[model samples]
Structures are given as C-alpha cells and as structure tokens.
Target: MTAVLSARGWTGSTFRSLRTRNYRLFATGQVVSNTGTWMQRIAQDWLVLSLTNSPTAVGITTALQFLPMLMFGLWGGVLADRYPKRRLLIATQSCMGLLAAALAVLTLTGTVRVGHVYLIAFLLGLATVVDNPTRQSFVTEMVGESDLRNAVSLNAAIFQAARLVGPAVAGVLINAVGAGWAFGVNALSYVGVLTGLLLMRPAELYPSPRVARARGQLREGLRYIAGRRELVWPIVLVGFVGTFGYNWPIILSAFAKDVFHHGAGTYGVFNTLMAVGSLAGALLAARRTTTRLRMLLAAAAGFGVLEVVAALTPWFWLFCPLLLVIGLLGLTFNTTANTTVQLACSPEMRGRVMGVYMLVFTGGTPIGGPLIGWVTETYGARDGLAVGGAVAALAAATVAAILAFARHDGTPVSIRSAVGTLTGRRA
Candidate 1:
C-alpha cells in the first residue's frame, strides 16, 4: 500500500523528466522553496504599504529589490559558469531563508521600520543576482536534451501554482496571526527545498564544464548576442513586456486597494485567479516537445489584448477574470520566448546567454515600474495598464515585421508555424 501510494504520487508525467534523480530532487525542493518565496514577496509588499502609504515609495522599494539584478546580472552569469550551480544555489537559498527569518523577528517585535525593509530588500536583491542565473543554468544540467523543455515549462508551472497558494495563505495569515506570522511560515517553507537539495543523488546530476573565459567577457557576451538576430529579438520582446505588462501584481495590488476600494482578501483572490490562468498556460507549454516563434509572437499580441480588456473593465468583480486571461496568455508568450532562447543557445554560452535574457526580462522592470507607478499615481490605474498593453502590442508588431523581412532559412522556425504553435490553432 505504501509503495502504491508513492508510485501514484510520482506519476508517469511527474517522472517523465526524472530519469535523472537530481532533477526530481531539485523539482521537489523548488516546489516548497518557490511557494515560500512568493509568500514572502506578498508579505513584504503589504508590509511596505503598511509602513509607507505612498505608491511611489512602494515602486521605489520594488526597484531597489531588482536593481542588483540589473547591475550585476552579467557578472552573476559569469559566476554561474565559474562555479558549481548546485553549490551556488544551496548557499543562496540558505541565505535567503535566514533573511526572511530575521525580518520576521523584526516585524513581529514591532521594531521593523521602513528603512529596515529597504536594507533587507537590497541585500536579498544582491543574493538573487547570483541565484537567478545559476538556477536557470541548473535546469539544463538536470534534464539534459531529452526533457529540457518539459523541465523548464514544469518549473514555471510549479512557480505559478505556488503563486496561487502563497498569496492566499499569506493574506489569511496576515489578517489572523499578523504579517510576522506569514514571514515565519515562509521561513519554514525553505526547509523542504533545502532538504531536497541535500538528499539528491550526486551521480544523477549532469556534468557541467567550468569554462575559463577571458577577463572583460561581459563585452564578449554582448558581442555574441549582437550577432544573432533570432536570439536578441526575443530577449528584447521579453524585456518590454516583462518590465511593464508583467508588473500586474504589484501595480494591481495598489489599484485594487486605493482605486477600487477592495480589501486584502479580494486582492489575494485576484492574484489567485491569475495564477490559475498561468498554470494552465505553463501546462500547455509543458505538453509540447517543441516551440515555434510565430506562436510566441501571437501569444505576445494576445497578452496585450487581454491586458487592455482587463484595464478597461469597469467593475472589480468584472476585472478579476480578465486577469486570469492575461495571466494565461502572458505565460504562454513568456515561456515560449524563454524556451526558444535556451534551446537555440550552445551549452558553452548558456549562462551568459540566459543572463542577457534575464537582463531584458528583469532589467526592464526598474525602468517600467517607476513609469507605471507614475501613471497610476498621476493619471489612474487604468491608464497604467492601458499604456503597458499598448507598448506590448507595438513590440509584438515589430517582431512580426522582422519575421517578414528576415531570412529564417538557417533556423528551423518560420513565421507561420510559430504563430500556429503559440495560438494552438491550425497552421
């Protein structure tokens, strides 16, 4: 009975990419760790607003948290290639867990100040500088060529699934026990992931070569990307969309509270619905063995359309379900764009390549968050969403035009099939 239950838990699909035990272990840890990470994120944001009632201040705080990624991401990519990914991840995760615990203590004791949150947020950002690229490269190391796409998609799916659980629980816990309790729960959540990482069979992990590149290799990474149209364009797309449109949660949190006059519980439900949509999108991507550029392009456009609809919807209750659609199409575009870049890059260049990819995805936020905040503060919440959607639409159209002019002969992908794959419609 025990074996049967265990087998049922690890279904054929769960283990599809887990012939490598290392991946299975990593996935298990991530499920726990990522959920905690999301919980902490929600708690932190709420805590910030509780301390400082300014929307601009919250945006600035978000900016500080991501600034390290913008400045040090290339260096982080270099570090990933220089060190063991698993070792780096273990250390980073431990540090982050401790940081959460410390914050919990401060907040619970009523000694927490806005300045404390800023300092801690900056430190956490610094840790993430190294953590993000290492984790991205680690995926390929675990699954190899056989199930790389599946692993990536599944990884995203779990992240979104945790998104659903984390904020909901955090909202309830914050209202009941206090925000400190949410942080404590998050601190505890890291234990499961850390344990999974430690218990993984080392032999099942893929061998990664620590290549010695010349000093000033950041420029080299830039030059490498400059020459590849296929690689560079998608990264650009992600940067624009991610920086602006992808900031729905942070922006919408304020909108829901200040503009719509909703409670924290309603805010949690809004995020939960978006997560549901995101999970569906990730699962759809996971089922596909290959990705197409056209699909990514179309999904990008669809995301913009959904965002516009979400922004224009008059009532809070009416706006909620549109967020789910936005989440769905947004993930579809994002995952396809991400997987395409990974599959296209050579192993030697994966870390650096993904660094630039992440740079665009994350780096845009520092610029976009402020702009969106300004719009939300000055014009209104609807204006912020509408403007972001417009930017996304334009970016998508630009990609379409490029696809029309470029010779895609060298690449396995073309414009038509790519669009069909993204929409899941007939080619």
Candidate 2:
C-alpha cells in the first residue's frame, strides 16, 4: 500500500503543471513547436556540414545564431518587463516562423549557400533574444510561484520528448527528400504556438506590472544580480558549463562523420538516445518539490565526468549509452540552475534576471562553438571533447569553492572543510 501510494504521488507530480488551463494550452503549442525546433537544429547542422564538408562551418553557424544573445539578451529581458509577455511572444514567434520559411525556400530552391545560412542564423538569434526571457518569465504568470519549478521541469521534458521525435523524422526527411523539408515543417509548427497564444484568456493571466521606461534600466538589472551572492554562483557555473560542456553539435557531428564514418542516420540515432535520457532527467526533476545547491553541483560534476568518459571510448556501442548519461546530467543542471535563479528574484526583476541567466548560459555558445570546432578539426574529435569536459569539471570545482566561501560563517575553516560543509561530506 505504501509503495502504491508513493508511485501514485510521483506520477501525479510529473504532470501537475498541466492542471492549469493556460499552461496546458501553452504546453500543447510548445510540444509541436519544440519538435519543429529540434528538427531544424539537426537539419541545420547537417546542412552546414554537407555544404562545406567542414565541422568549423557548422560551428560558425552555431556562433552566428547565438551571438546576439551575447550582445542583446539583457535588453530582451527589459522588454519583457516593460511589455506584456503574451503579446511580445506573439511577435517574436511570428518573426521566427517567417525566418524558418525563408531558409526553407532557399534550401529547397537550390540557391542556398553558407553565407545565406549565416545571415538567417543571425536573424533567428535576434528573435530569440526577446523570446527566451519572455517565455521563461511568462511561466510565472501561467502557473504562479507554487508550480513554477514543476512547469519548468515539464517544459524541459516536453522539449526533450519532441527532440526524440524531431531528429528521427529529420533524418528520414533528409535522406528521403532533403534538408529543406525539415525547415518547412518547422516553419509550419509555429502555427501551433500562435494558435495557443491567441486562444489564451487575458483575464486568466497573473501579469506583472509593466515597468515605465527609464534610464539605467539595464544597469539596474546588473546591480540587482551583483548584490546577490547566492545568485552569482549559478550563473557563473552555467556560463562555464554551457560554453565548454554543451558543444554537442560540433563534437557529435565530428564523431559521426569523421570518427565513426557514419551518415545522417547515425547522427539522428545519437540525438534520439540522448533525448531519451534528457526526458527521464526532466521527469525526475519535476517530481522533486525543491532543489539544493548540492544537487546542482553534483549534476554539473557528473555531466563533466561522463563527457570525458564518452570522449575516451573507442567503441561505437559504448559511446551511445554515455551520451544518455551526459544528457541526463546536463538537463538536470540546466533545470536546477534555471529554477534557482527564477525563484530567488522578485517578480518585477524576474524577466531581467532570467535574461541575464540565459545570456551567460547560451550566449557563450558563440565563443565555444568555433573553438571546439577548430579543436575537433585540428586534434581529432576525441581530444576536442576531452578538452571541453576538463574545462567543465574544473569550472564546477571552482564554483563549489566559491559557494564554500560565501556560506562559511566567520570561523577558521580551511577551504576543504568549507567545501565539505556544502557537499555534506568530508572533502
């Protein structure tokens, strides 16, 4: 009876966020849109690789897509605060759909070039700068504070679930037709999101008051983060992990084409398996009522350790399962970091806080993508992945030390002892 009750409790929690009507609608749209997004991701990376026969070109595409986040992500958060999230999302999502359509037309018409890809990627990045933060902060409006964490976890799960379907379909599409069809499908997927957004009842939303336009708004957000030591460490940790540890498009593609001598099918399979693990991790995260610093740090360390293991394996069979574990730990770290930052800040500041959080988290991709791509090109895929894992692991340790320093009472404790205190074990 006890076991039955426990199982029931866990099962119920896994989909608790869907109880809210608005969230259910939002999620319904996201599942389709997210699936399309993943399809595009796989298709885009593969497209770049085929066009140039260079992993570096793939990295350059990635860099171009995320470069705007490094430049204008925070301002996006400012807009989220100053405007209604739903309305902002409508505009951004429309822009994204149009961009996808344009790319599809180019690729389908046989006039596509690497230069055209670079430009479209940059335009998409511009749309994302606003969309990312507003979408994140909008969750608070949908489910309120009580279910915020669950919604975030479920959102991750939904995205990963789509990932499972997206890449597989993209692989088939690429093989049977061409990459252009995948882009076309993704462009159509936006209809789901737009429909959901349009159907939402304005009265149901828990909207934050719009901030009046003022000078130093951007600086204000920075100061808000600077004053909170607790908030600072997670951002720092995610920045390093995101920049170094999350270059899968570069490393995995290189492994598929150059190292394993496989084609699009194997690449799609690798992504699907990782999506399986990511979905599991997100579902597990949703069941939890709270998260601790120890859990977040542990996930970060595990992700790094597993990436190194994945890099070292010479057998193709062994490499596949390693990606699953890597995906699980990676998603765990991301969801925890995201929920932590959001829960710690006040409502008025939530948008900017999430913006800054995403800035470091994804903005660093531009720098990491090209560097890792070059490393793969020069030293082989194995060494490139190993280098990234090392950096991530070291960054996790550094952040752990920072946490120790911040939390230590003014006692004469060694760094090791302080670290032990945070991890609840002897260092």
Candidate 3:
C-alpha cells in the first residue's frame, strides 16, 4: 500500500493545479500567449537575420530583449510588492500584445528595418521587467502555499511544451508565407491571456497586502535575502549555473556544427531533446508534494556533472543521448530552486525575491553567452561544456558546504561532516 501510494504520487497528472478556477483560466491564457510569444521569438530572429545577414545583429537583438530584465527587474519586483499582480499582469500583457501587433504590421508592410526590430525588442524586454516578477509571485496567490510547487512545475511544463511546439510552427509559417503572419498569429494569441485576466474572480485571489511606498524598499528586500540562508544559497546557485551552465545556445550549436559536423538540422535536434527532457523533468517535479533544499543541491550538482560527461563523450550518438539527461538535470535544478526560493520568503517580499531570482537566472545569460562562446571558439565545444558544468557543480557543492557549516545543539559542526549531512549522507 505504501509503494502504491508512492507510485501514484510520482506518476500523477501534473494538471492537478489547473483545478483552481482562477489559475485554470490564467494558465489557459498563458499557454496560448506563450505559444505566440515563442512564435514571435523565432519569427523576430528570422526577420532580423534576413534584414542584416549578420549573426551579430541577431545577437544584439537577443541582448536587447534581456537587458531590461537585468536593469529594471528589481524595480519591477518592487512594483509587484506595491501593487496588485493581476492588474500589473494585465497592463504588461497588453503592452506586449500591442508590441507584437505593431511588429506584425511593420513586417507585413514591407517597410520594416533591423532598427525597428531592435527598438521593439528592447521595449518588449521593458514590459517583462514587471511581468516576470508579477507573474511569478502571482502563482502563490492563485493556488496558495499548499499547491504552489505544483503550480510552479506546471508553469515550467507549459513553457517547455510551448517551446517544443512554437519554434517548429513558426518555422513552418515563416517558410510557408512569411514572418509577418507569424507575428500576426502571435498578436492574436494575446486575446487568450487578456480574456483570462478579465475573467479571473478577484475575490478568489489570496493577495498579499500592497507594500507601502517607501524609500528603501529595494535595500530592504536585499537585506531580507541576505539574513536568510535558505534564500541566499538558492539564488547564488542559480546565478552560477545560469551564467555558466545554461548557455546551451552557444555550447550546443558549437557541438552540432564543429563537433558533429552537421549544421542547423543537428542544432535543432539537440534543442528538441533538451526541451523534451525539461518537460519530463517538470512533470516529475509536479508530482512531489514537498520541496527540499537537498533536492536543489542534488539536481544542481548533477546538472554540472552531466555537462562535464557530455563534453567528453567522443561518439556522436553518445553525445546526443547525454544531452537528454543533462536537460533533465537542468530543469530539475531550475524548478527546485524556483519553488524553494518562492516558498522560503515572506508574502510581502515574494515579488522582490522572485524578481531577483529571475534576474540572476536570465541576466547571466548575456554574460555567459559571450564568455562561453569565446571559450568554445578558442578551445572547443567540449571544453566549453566541461568548464560550465564544472562551475555549476562546484557552486552546488559550495552551497552545500555553506549550508552545513552551522552550529547545531550548541556545538560547531565541521565543514566535512556538515556537507555530508546536508547532502544526505551520515558523517
């Protein structure tokens, strides 16, 4: 009977979080909008590449989209703590839709320039400065703490699932008609999210009280994280891993082109496998009722180790399959860290915490991408993966040791013994 219960929990449908009416609506809208978002991403890139024929132009567009999050993400989190997330989401989502619509119009009209693409990309990034945190913290409001982990997992699954479908569909659209129609479809996708927001019953949401306007709220949020060990380590782990480990675009493409001796086709295959593993990992996370710090450490370390192993694999078939395991570990680390951080903080500060969480998780990419690219170019793809994986694993182990090195029962714990216990072994 115990085994049966365990099996059921492990394999249960991840869609259980969708049982809440408000969340169900919100999620429904997100899936549609996310699909469109991914579509626009591919089409936008294709449009830029077509205009300038320069990979540098493509990189700049990518950088512009993420720069706002790095710059204003904390401020966005501050706003989330100060206002209603639903209203904020509504405003942000609408702005995003309008931007997509404008881009569609520009592209379809045959007057679009690379400059136009760059400006819009930056503007869209600006919207996400608020949207990312508001959307993240709002999950707790939608489902409360009991179901928060499940909801977060479902969110990851949805994004990855859309990721799987969106790019392929966008490729078809771009090839069949043009990038313009893809943008148009993405613009229409906003209707789903907007309708979801408009229809959500305000009374059902478990909102944190709005933060009073204050001068030092940002510093307060930082201090909140600083004093708490649980919060600090997870965010640090994400920063190390996100910056060094998650730059797959640079590392994987290099592997496919230089190592595998294939072109865009192999690159797509590697990405698809990664997405598939991520989706599976997310579903696996949705089944567990509890989130643990130990799980985060394990997954983070495993992710790094797998990258090292993947980098050294000599055969193409061996390298390809390793990516799936690496992808799984990557998503597992991400979801665990996300759930842990959100659960560890106070309701009032959830927004700020998540904003910081996202800032490190994504903002590092700009830094990591170029650094890893240079490493890959200078050495090889194998070295790039090995170096990134090593950093992630080392960060995970370091955090574990830090977490373990505390006094217990009025006695000091040695680092070696503490790390062993923290990592789930008896010393």
TM-score of 1: 0.92
Q: In lDDT terms, which candidate is top?
A: 2
Instruction: Report the C-alpha displacement of residue 375, candidate 3, in angstroms.
Output: 3.6
> Which sections of candidate 2 miss by over 4 Å?
1-11, 405-427
Model 1 lDDT tens row, 217-331? 7887788878666577788889888888877646767776887887667777878888999989988888887677778888899898778887888887778878888889988
TM-score of 2: 0.93
- Judging by TM-score against the true structure, name the best candidate: 2
Across residues 380-406, which tens digit of lDDT does each residue of candidate 3 receive? 889988999999999999987777564
Candidate 1 vs candidate 2: the lDDT winner is: 2
Worst 10 residues of 2 by lDDT: 1-10
Model 3: CA > 4 A from native: 1-13, 45-58, 109-113, 252-266, 314-316, 376-383, 404-427
User: Could you report the Cα RMSD, in angstroms, for every candidate shown?
Assistant: 4.2, 4.7, 5.3
Backbone atom clashes (below 3 Å) for every candidate: 5, 0, 0
- Whole-model lDDT values for every prediction: 0.79, 0.89, 0.81
Question: What does the lDDT read for residue 40 in candidate 2?
Answer: 95
Q: Give the lDDT of residue 226 in candidate 2.
A: 87
For model 1, give the 10-residue run with minimal summed lDDT. 1-10
Between which residue pairs do clashes occur in model 1?
A: 294-418, 294-419, 295-418, 295-419, 295-422
